[model samples]
Target: MSLANIFDTAASAMSANTVRLNTTASNLANAESAASSIDETYRARHPVFAAVRQQVEALSFDTLDAGQTETQGVQVLGIVESDAPLQQRYEPDHPLANEEGYVFYPNVNAVEEMTNMISSSKAYQMNVEVMNSAKTMMQRLLTLGQ
Candidate 1:
């Protein structure tokens, strides 16, 4: 509703996008990693964001009190691992292969991860733009007063 709220929302989005990009990078880096067992395999990770609400309403002269207020920012609840099945490679000649001639690969999808990284990076940049625009507008308002 206010300029401050827009800034807050953009900042929170940028933070969440940062986490997304970091996790995507990690997943892409381990996409080709080979593991002897499923336990050692890497799983794709993602962050969960939750909306925060105002607990108490502030008293004001003109503005009426709203019982529930939705904040413009979000908080990361936690990171979750992908539960998809692991990749099974038939590498009988490979030394790391198990007795059954099977090697376990990580569940990371390199292409998907790369795409996610790009999207997150763009989202972060967009948020930066939002912040810059807000700052410029505020500066222009100061000039109006002068």
Candidate 2:
């Protein structure tokens, strides 16, 4: 891989991590939300990621080295709602309670969401560090001519 590709890779990672953090935050925010029906309740959302690949010309003049594949970075496929069951509680007096005296809560797990948040944050920080390191390396390379 070329040195310049480092920036693109890191940038893509940072973007993917940002999406993960946002989804985690949203899950946490709706963790306590209540709904009158299971269909209306919020579901824990998660982002799916996929590896992005690119075809590059081989560095050699040989015909066998014509096309090579390299991973560019990560791409978010889409956000998916968790299949976990929603929380149902008997709260007869609650305003949002259904006729059956039950309230439906989102399936979000606070602890899991918190863990995801932390992981995403750490990943983002790591990407930032990678970018900084790449920048420093590029600067040092500039001085190699002198």
Please, what is the TM-score per model?
0.85, 0.90
> Hey, what RMSD does candidate 2 come out at?
3.3
- Summed backbone clashes in each candidate are 0, 0
Candidate 1 to truth, TM: 0.85
> Clash pairs of candidate 2?
none
Predicted candidate 1 versus true structure: per-residue lDDT over 1-146, tens digit per residue: 55656787898898899888888888888888898788888888888878865543534457775544345677889899998899999999987798899999988888788888889899999999999999898889889967
Which numbered prediction scores highest in TM-score against the true structure?
A: 2
> Which 10-residue window of candidate 1 scores lowest in summed lDDT?
52-61
Mind giving the per-residue lDDT tens digits that candidate 2 earns over 1-146?
76778898999999999999999999998999999998899999999999998876555556555666464999999999999999999999999999999999999989889999999999999999999999999999999999
Q: Each candidate's lDDT (Cα)? A: 0.83, 0.91
